[model samples]
Target: MSDPDADDREGSVPEAATPKKKKPKKKRAAEPSAGGVAIRAVRLSRWYGKVTAVSEVSLHLGPGIWGLLGPNGSGKTTFMRMIAGQIKPSKGELTVCGEAPFANPNVLARIGFCPQEDSLYDELTGLEFVSAMAELSGYDRVSAERRARAALEEFGLEDAMTRKMGGYSRGMRQRAKLAQTVVHDPDVLLLDEPLTGTDPSSRHQILDALQRRATAGALVLFSTHVLPEVETLTDQLLLIARGQVVAQGGMDEIRQLLDEHPHHIRVQCERPRELASRLMTAEGGIVGLSFRGPDVLEVHTWQPDETYAAIGRQVLESGMKLRSITSPDANLEALFHYLVQRANRGSGMGADAGTGAGPRLQSAAEKAAYEAQLDVGGGR
Candidate 1:
C-alpha cells in the first residue's frame, strides 16, 4: 500500500485533473543564512547496522538557543551526537562551524557536548571533574581550575564542589555535568536532557547560564521531552519525531498548524450550568462540553477567541462570579500531541489504531522498543 503521508507533487496528477488555479507553494523548512549558519545538515542519516537511529534529516541553525524538542528515542540524542562529532553519519553531510566535524580536532575543540549518560569519574570531586574537563579542552592547570571553579559556582555547585561525584544526588550530578560542559566556553554547545533530574532553582540557574551563552553568540542546542522547559529557554524550535524533522519554526508557526484541532478551555465559576447554557445558546462555535464539577465546566471550541469573548460578556452581564478561565491547549505540549496524532493518521495509521497513541505514551513505547532492540543487539 502507498504511504498516505507521502507528499503529492503537482506533476504526479493527471493533466486533465489539474486545477486551473495555481496552488500555493508548500513552505520549505526553515534555513539559516550562510553568513550566520552555525550548524547545517543535508540528508543526514545514522544507523546501527539493521536499526536506523536517525533517518534522512536536514536542519539549519544559527547562533542562538534552539530547542531540539522530541521524546526519548525520537533521534534527538543521535542527531546531537552526530553534530558533536562523536559519531559519523551513515549518509549525507553535516557541518559545525562551517567545517566537517568527525575526526577534526579543530572543529571538535569548538564544540562542547554533555552526553545523557552519567560518565563522571566517581573518584573525582565535583571541582576536580570539571577542572579535568577544562584542562582537556586545552586550558592550563591554573586557568582550568579557575574556570572550573567559576562554572561550578555559576551552576550553584559551590557548596558541593568538594563532594565526591558518587556521593552527589541525581540533581547535583546533573549540575556537575553541566558545569563541566560549559567550563571551556566552547562556541557550540550540545546538551542532551540537561534539565533532567534538576531542582527548580537549579533548572533556573542552568537556563540563565544557557541564555547568557546564546547572548554571547554561542550556538546552543539542547534536547528535552519537557515542553515547558523549552518554552522557558527559547522560542526557536526544531521538533523531531520518528527520526524525522516533523516541524521547524517558532511556537506561533507550530500553533498555526494546530488550528484545525479543537481548543480546550476550562472555566471555574459560581454558575456553571447557567454559564454553560448561556454559552450554548449564544454561540454555535462550541463543539464539546462537559462538567468537571458543580462549579466547573470543560469546553472545547473551534473558535477560541470568539468563545472567550462571549464568556467575558456573559459573565459581566449576568452578574455571574467567575473564578478563572484557562485554555489547556494553549501550550507546546498540546501542539506536540496534535502534530504527532496528525502525522500518525497521515502515515496510514488510523486514529483508533495501536500506533495512534498520544505523544507522551508513544514516546514511552518508542523508548522501550529502542532499549529492547539495543539489548538484543548486545548493547551496541
Candidate 2:
C-alpha cells in the first residue's frame, strides 16, 4: 500500500554547490558492552536450500531498546530466530548470554520471546498457561503465580486472565502472549510485532511495558515494518535489507550514509542577511542559501558535518552570536526511507514491489486491509 506520508518529490532535491566527501566504509556493529552482551551473532548466515534467508549478519546487542526495522521479506524473522535459538544458523555462531542458544535451558531463561505466530493451547486459560511457563522457567509455584499476576496486571489483562484462549479477542490474546513472554522476568526480550492487532489503548499499554523493561536494564528488541512505531519507540536502529545489515547504528550515523544529500537548516541570527551572504562563500560544503523569514536563513548543504562546523567557525570569526540553528531535514524517517529506496533499487527487486504490485493501481480491498490494520492501532 502507498504510504500517505510518502515523500513529496516535487522540487525536493536542492541545487548542488559544495563538493561531496569520499564516503566512509560502512561501520561494522560494535562489540557488546562490559555490563555484558545480551546477544551476539558472528558471521551468522542462514539458508533455505538454494535460497539464502540471512547472510553474514554480525551484531552485538547491549542493554537498552533496539528496533529491528525492515520491509516484509527482509530476513528480519530469520535473523531473530537465529538469535532466539528457535533456528540454527547454517553457518557461523550466535550466542545468547555468552552461550550457544539452541536448546540451552540456562540461556533460554535469560530470554523472553514473543513470536509473531501464536502458540497457545485453546483450552487453557491465560493465567494457567503463563503460570505454568513461569514455573517451568524454574520459579517455585508461589513465585510463578505471583509473577504471572504482576505481568497480567501490567498488560491490563488481569480481568481476562481466566478467560479461555479460544474465546479471547485478538487484542486480548496478544496481551496474554506478551504477559507469558515476560512472566519469567527474562533479561532479554525479543518481541516480533508485539503490538499487532491491538487498539490504541492496548498498543500504548504494551509500549509502556516495553519501555519500562528497557529502563530496567533489559535488552529489548522488537521487529516492525511500521516507520512511525520505530520512530516513537527507539532511535537505536538495526536496519536490514535482503539478509544483510545495510545500516546499523544511532540516528545520526544512519543519516551520514546519504550521498550528495542536501538538508535545509533553519538559522535564526542577529543579522540574517549577513549570515546568508557569508554562508554563500564558505568552502567545505555550502549547497544553497535562502532567506526563510525576516531573521532566519534556510541553508542547504551537502556535507552537514563540515558545513555545521564551518558555520560555527564563521560565527566566531565575525564575533556574531546567533540565537538558534536547527536542521529540520535531518530526521529519522527521511533517512530511513531514503536508505530503503536505495536498497530496493540496488537489489533490482522490481520497481513496484515495495508498495505497488502491478499497473492496475491500488484495489479497494487492499486499501481496506491497510486501513483496517491502522484503525486497530496495529502497525503490522
Candidate 3:
C-alpha cells in the first residue's frame, strides 16, 4: 500500500536551476502549499496488531461531497476515526485545516464528525443532546439552543427533538445524531454510514442537507457501501478494497479505466455459420463460439484487439454483413467483480466480503431529482 502522505512529499523535491548558485537549495514551490485545509492525509495508515486496518492511504478532499466507498473491513471507519483524531495511525501524518487533528482544539473546533456507532446520550432528549454538542463546539448558550432547533427542523425532526433518544426508533436516532454533528456549523463534515438504518425518506433528507452544506462551502465527505448513492450524490469516488485504494476519480473516468483493461470479448453478428467458420479457420482460432439463433453468432475471444480486428477485416474482405458487436459483459458491475475476485485470489483472503452492497434504487424524492435533471436536458 502506498502512503497517502507520499503524494505531497514528492512536491518537495527540487530541480536544479538553470543558473548555478552558491549552494543548491530545494525549491519550496514544488511541494503543495499549506494554509487552508479541507483535509489532508499523508501516508496515513492504521493497523490492529497483525491485521492492518487501513493501509498507507493518502487523500486530499476539497469543499464538496466526496464518497468514501468500500466493502466491510476495508478501513472506511478506521480512516474516518483517524480524521477525527480519536485513533492515531501507526505511521504517516494526518492534518485537518493545516493542524494535527488528534486532540487539537483549533482543528477539532472547525470539524464535525458523525461516527458509525450510535453516540447519543440514551438518557438525554434529542434537543438536549444536540444542545450539548453545540456547546462543545463553542456556541453560546442562546445560539446553541437556536441552532439545535433549526437543525432539527431541517432534518424534519422538530417534533421528535424533545423526545428521549432511548425510546427513539433506529431511524429517528440516526437523524438525531446527524443533527448534532452539524449543530455548530463546522466547516468540515465527516459522516460514516450516516444513511444506515435510515428509511428511504430519511436518507433523502440527509443527502439533501449534506448537499446544502457542501454548496455552502463546507468540505463534506461520507463513507458508504452504496454504489448508486455514491454515483448520484457525488461525482468523485474513492474506492477502497482490502484496506487499499483500488480506484479513485470521477465515475466516468473509473469506467474508462475498466474499459482499458483486458477482458473476454463477446460479439454477436448476423451471420453465425459464416463468421464462426471464418474465425475458426483464421490464425487466432476462436477462443469460444456458439450460435444462439439462425443469424446470431456469439464469438468469444480472450484477445479483444485481435478479435475485433479479425472480425472487422473479415467483414471487409469476405463482404459479410454484420449486426451489433457488443461486449455483453462490459459494465461497472463486471469491472467491480473482476477487481474483487483478483484481490481475493491474490491475497487468499476469501474471508473478506466480496463487494459492498449497492444502495437500493432512488426513493420518490430521488426520482423527482432524476426527472428534474432530465427536464434540464442533463445527461445521466
Candidate 4:
C-alpha cells in the first residue's frame, strides 16, 4: 500500500511537496459605540428555558426610525423586550443607551416601551393612565399630568383624553398608549405593532408623530409585519425571521442586496427564443431559462433589473416586438420567503450574520449553545 501511492502522496519528493494553504484570519466583531440615543446588540440572544426566542443577533443603531420587520411569532417582541429591560438575554451583550438594560434603573428610565398587547387600565381615564405613566418616569403630579395632556393631544387623543379607557375604541386606546409612551419623552422608543387597529386618520397622525420623534433624534425602533409601513416610516430596515436577522438596509442598500440573489422574471415578447438566446449570453448574470409559452420565457437571473433592462434594449435594437416583463417575486414577502428558504437550505445566509453597521464575526455567544437546553424549545 505504501509503495502504490507514495510518489503521489509526497509529490514525488519532499522538496517538491505543495505548500499548504493558510486559513484566513477571522476579523474581530467591532463593539458598537455607546453614546447618545442608540441600541447595540453583540450576538444578543434570549431563551426561555428550552425555547430559543431571539438567537445570536447583532446590530448597531443610532438615533433614527429603524423598522423592525418580521412576521407574527418572529421573535420581534422578545427582542424588543430584551432591549426594554423586561427580559434578560440568555447570552450575549446588549446595551441600550450604553448600559445593560435588565434591572438597570437609569437605562429603564431612559427607554420607552409599548408592548403589542392591550395594557391600558379599563377604569382609568386616558389622561389618568398617561399621567401615571409619566409619574413612573419620575415626574411629579403637576408636571406628569401636564406632559400627559400634551402627549395625548400630540397623538390625536384630545377628544378622548377625559374618557375612561373602557369606553375607548381600539384606535383610541392605541393613541392613549402612544401618548403614555411619549409622555416620559425617553430617548429610545420601542413600539411593538403600534398601529395594530388604527384607522387611516389615526395611522397618519401616529406615523407623523413617530416621524417627528425620529427627526428629533430619538432612536425609534418599531416592529411590524406590514412591509409598506416600514418603507413609509423609514428607509432603515431590519428584517428578521426564525429569530434571526435575514437582511437589513436602506433603499439603496436593499437594491444592491437583491443582486446577490437569483430573481426569476417572466418575459412576454413576440419572439421568445430570440430574446432567450440573446439573454443566455449577456456578459454573464443569467442563471437559467425556461420557456413558459410560445411567446414567454421565464428567466432566472442574479440581476433582475439589469436583465430586464437588457431585454428591453435588445428588443429595440433588433426590431423585435416586446410585450411586457414581470417578476413574480419582486415584492417584500417574496424576498423574505426566498432568503429564509435559502438559509434553511444552507446557502450560507445563516452563516453570514451581521449588521452592515457592524463587522460580521463569529460571536462569542456561539460557545453558549450549552445554554440551549434551558430554552423552551420553540422560538416565539
Structural similarity to truth (TM-score) of each candidate: 0.74, 0.68, 0.68, 0.77
The C-alpha stretches of model 3 lying farther than 4 A from their native spots are: 1-34, 258-260, 263-334, 347-380
**Alpha-carbon shift of residue 62 in model 1 (angstroms):** 2.0
Question: Which residue runs does candidate 1 get wrong by more than 4 Å?
Answer: 1-37, 281-284, 313-319, 344-380
- RMSD, one per candidate, in order: 17.8, 19.6, 16.1, 20.6
Total clashes in model 4, counting residue pairs 3 or more apart in sequence or in different chains: 11
Best by lDDT, which number? 1
**How much lDDT does each candidate structure score?**
0.75, 0.71, 0.69, 0.74
- lDDT tens string, model 3, 237-305? 666677765665565566555543454545555566877788887755356777777877767555666
What's model 2's overall lDDT? Answer: 0.71
lDDT tens string, model 4, 44-103?
878788887787776667788888877766688999999999998998889888899999
TM-score of 2: 0.68
lDDT of 2 by residue, 1-380 (tens): 34211221242212221121122243221223323546766557899999877876656676778888877888889888877889988996778778888887767777888888866788999889889988787655665676787788888888889888888888888889899889876778899889888888998899988888788778888988666777788877877777766666666655664454576678888887877777778885777888878888888888777888888887777777799999876666666666677676774232122221122225777544433332111111
- lDDT of candidate 4 vs native? 0.74
Candidate 1, residues 1-380, lDDT tens digits: the string is 33211222223433332442244353231122333437877567898988877766655677888888776677888999999998999997788878889988767778889889866788899999998998787655666777788888889989999989999988889999998888877778899999889989999999999998888778899998878989878877777776666666677755655556787889999998888888888784899888999999988898888999988888998898999998777688877776666554665122111211212224656645532322111000
Which regions of candidate 2 are displaced past 4 Å? 1-37, 257-261, 264-300, 305-329, 347-380
